[model samples]
Target: MVVLKKKEMMQCYTFFLLIIVVVASAIPTKADDQKKRVKEKSLSDASHSEDGEHNNDYDHEAFLGKEERQTFDQLSPEESRDRLGKIFEKIDKNSDGFVSEDELKDWIQYVQKRYITTDTERMWKDYDISDTNEITWNAYMKRTYGYGDAGEPKEGDPVYEYRDMITRDKRRWERADGNNDDKLNKEEFSNFLHPEDAEHMREIVVLETLEDIDKDKDGFISVEEYIGDMLSDQKKGEPEPDWVVNERKQFTDYRDKNKDGKMDKHEVMDWIIPTDYDHSSAESKHLIYESDKDKDGRLTKQEILDKHDLFVGSQATDFGEALTRHDEF
Candidate 1:
């Protein structure tokens, strides 16, 4: 009878041992399944990111790229805008709302950015007007564009619908080139801000746009390597200098006024034409009022075109006289 009891106890112990083993083996399998699920979810998230639907916030530091972050940090936005403005105004002819596509190309070349030939594919995507490989002011001021003017938002604006400085810029661009001209050719534009004014304005804008790219301590930008860099997702050098970074931030106050991403012409100009704003000649202003039959203080396309030749001839004469004076001096 004792032997029989011992055998029964052994069987009970055996069953318990088997149960323990099964539980132990099941625990590992369950844990592994959980881990696999988590890993698969992580992979799915990564795939979603690669599809480009992610809404990552603007990372200016990362945008600066490894090579330029050091220099970009050194200069302020004010200095950058000041420098770029000088270059832009110098090349801009019509003092109009926008720079012509050709002028912009020249500027890119001047800054050492990659150059796309006039006839290259999508070359005119930035400015093409008639599908004839030409650019027009109307096209330049496309309301849908980030830089295009869509007019101003008045007081008591809605929370989401309030227009900002980009809107103003678009409106300014449209108003400046009202004639639907293909481009602001050299003769059509002039500087609203002359040497001193242009200098101040340029400093303000350049600092904001091209800050910290000056690897060399020299005031002027040595190269325009940031075009490609800006388009990538890379970490730049150490933090930019306080002054240089400050200028960039300050320029953003104006360039990105209203919290929009780009600038338009309205923010750049005032209604008063400069006394020195010689549209071909110093005498052109005299004809401005004469042409405004409606007396609204603005010249129409026909009116400006009517005297275009006269203005051209007067300017030529003035240029000659100035040359003669310089020779005499």
Candidate 2:
């Protein structure tokens, strides 16, 4: 059996959560084709019924909970600025004039934990039919697959509607059974819903990313492969964006450590999970760059309010929402 030290396990969890945040906030591109296909399938199911009976009530597009969906809607500039100011104040814990790296990191972890806890509780309630505070694989599959105790889906069942969920959750169950006990305790269930909390799951994600980007199937990502998604024009034959050109240069110059022409697994892993990386520091610098007007490397509450537009729709701008929905988590 493979054994991970406690500190190593914590690092894996942190690295996994950081990747989740980055991927969540990243600008969508053609490289997300697989995700796009899944999304498109859900949308298609929502719009049309195979049996010709329109089931528009099924909201296949809903990813967020009721409150989260409400909060995700756009706000006017004035309202957004007001909201941003409150957010900055909360993150600047200790009533400090500037947010420190520790403060920023704490805020990020808080947000991520809130999301995971909310999602996990929701799933637990759904599968825990006996109110026993634990879920067996049988109960989970029955609820998710919409099957009865007889071990099969009923006739006239909308099996197709849940095919994706079934497939995804079945794999999740296998991975979540960490002790191979065929059941998930509350903690394990949480890890099941949010795999970033499970250290072993991170390797799977890294491998998937490698497979997705290694276009030539040579076990490494070339410079072209690294920037392929960014370089591709959404409108055929159009020139790539200037930012894409800069990114291509960045990958070759900075990311290609040791002057290697290709990014091997270790190089890719470093690029994704840099050693001693502090997400808080990076986020703080970005906030200061956008809001600081005095050429200082810090932000005052007023300065944040003044340049709130820059932070809108960003993770830093929604502290209030995270707090307001705190009880749900």
| TM-score for each model | 0.20, 0.58
Residue range 39-93, candidate 2, lDDT tens digits: 1101111222222332221111111112242342345556555655666677788
Can you write out model 1's per-residue Cα lDDT over 30-105, one digit (the tens) per residue?
2221111111100011111112232111011111111112233233444433333343354355756334434433
Residue 63 in model 2: shift from native, Å? 20
Candidate with the greatest TM-score versus the true structure: 2
Q: Lowest-scoring 10 consecutive residues by lDDT in candidate 2?
A: 36-45
Off by over 4 Å in 2: 1-33, 36-85, 95-101, 138-175, 215-218, 229-238, 254-261, 292-298, 313-329
What's the residue-level lDDT of 83 in candidate 1?
33
Query: For residue 184, what is the lDDT in candidate 2?
Result: 87
Give the best candidate by lDDT.
2
Q: Give the Cα-based TM-score of candidate 2 against the true structure.
A: 0.58
**How many pairs of residues in model 2 come into backbone collision?**
0
